[model samples]
Structure formats: C-alpha cells, structure tokens
Target: MVTPVRVVIALCLFVPFVAMLWVGSYAKTDPAFIGIPFFYWYQMAWVLISTALTMIAYQLWRRDQRGRSSRKGGVAE
Candidate 1:
C-alpha cells in the first residue's frame, strides 16, 4: 500500500545518500567557497542538507503513522 507521502519520505531519505556517495559529482576544487575547496565545502553542505532531509522524513513518517492508526480506530501514539 505505497502512497505518495511514503514515496516522498523515501526520496527525502535516499537523496542525501546518493549525493554523498556520488563523489565524482563533487570531487573537484574549481568552485571554492571562502577558500574552502569544493570537495570540502560540498561535503559540509551535504551534512546540513542531510540533517534537513532527515527531519522532513521523520515528520512525514510520523504523520503517516498517525493517519494509519487513526484509520484503524486507534489513537496515535
């Protein structure tokens, strides 16, 4: 019983993994930020991005769980 909300949650969780693992995409120094190399800055940026994504996924999961429980006539925990 896959739902659009669930798919969005999955994407939120998966995007960071793909972005970090795809090193070739950020493995360079041409785009420096405040003297920090692209490789370094990119990884740091992803850290923040990953945290945001995780938070979003967590919220969506909680919302989905609440919806499921309510539909079953159970109180959300």
Candidate 2:
C-alpha cells in the first residue's frame, strides 16, 4: 500500500538529513559563493533547503493522511 508519492516524500525528508550530516563533503572553502566561505555558506544554504524540504514533507504527509482517512470513512485529523 505504500505509494510512489510517499516514497518521494520520504526521500525529500531523508536527503537533507544525510547531506547535513555529511559535513566532510562540504568542509572546504575553496568554492566561495558571493564572498561567503564554503563551510559557512554551505550550512546556511541547507538551513533554507531543510526548511523547504520540511514544508514539502508536511504537505505531502497531509495529503497522504487525507487519502487514508477518506478510505476509512473518517475526517483527517
């Protein structure tokens, strides 16, 4: 009963956690963006990315809950 949409939602939530956890991957500062060092800028950028991904996951979770509730003849909580 797991759907493709749910799989995509899980990926959206999982990817950012893995990316932020893998600090060594973006530890260098050679590639500065607009004068911001890679180390600082990279983490800052993920703050925004994480927020967006969380929002996406929330929306998708809501949709999935609605679907499940409808199938059970109950209102989504």
Candidate 3:
C-alpha cells in the first residue's frame, strides 16, 4: 500500500518535468510573448506549474504518511 503511494508521488514529481522538456523541445520560434520567445515562455510557465504541482504532491504525501501511521495504530478515524 505504502509502496504504491510512494510510486504515485514519484510519478507525479517526474511526469511534469518530462512534459516541460517535451514542450521546450518542440516549441515554435516566432510569436514571442512580450518579446520573450515561445520556447522560453512555455518553459517558464511549466516551471511555475511544476512548482505548484510539487508542493501539492508534497502535501498529499505527508497526508498519506499520516494516514498510514494512524491506520497502523487503529486510530485512523
């Protein structure tokens, strides 16, 4: 059970990073965002989103850990 939770957390952390790389690698050249290129802006936006997702994952991981501990003690209510 805990192993699955850990794996999910790892995937959540990694998938966004891969997505960022993919977006960066295939972005166009023109249509700059306020002078910044599409390649640059897209990566920057993903960086912010990734930070948010990481924070959310961390919170969920902490909650899962707490639940596991409480369940072990039969006090999870």
Residue 59, model 3: Cα distance from true site in angstroms: 0.4
Q: Report the lDDT of model 2 for residue 65.
A: 95
| Model 2 RMSD in angstroms | 1.4
TM-score of 3: 0.71
Give the Cα-based TM-score of candidate 2 against the true structure: 0.87
lDDT of each: 0.94, 0.92, 0.79
* Model 2 accuracy (lDDT, Cα): 0.92
Which candidate's lDDT is highest?
Answer: 1
lDDT of 3 by residue, 1-77 (tens): 45877887887799787887686574786778899988788778888888887987898788887888787986433
Model 2, which residues run further than 4 Å from truth?
none
* Better candidate number, 1 or 2, judged by lDDT: 1
Which sections of candidate 1 miss by over 4 Å?
Answer: 75-77
- Model 1 lDDT at residue 20: 92
Clashing pairs in 3: none
Predicted candidate 2 versus true structure: per-residue lDDT over 1-77, tens digit per residue? 78988998989999998998998999899799999999999899999999999899889999899989999999888
Residue range 1-62, candidate 1, lDDT tens digits: 89999999999999999999998999999788999999999999999999999999999999
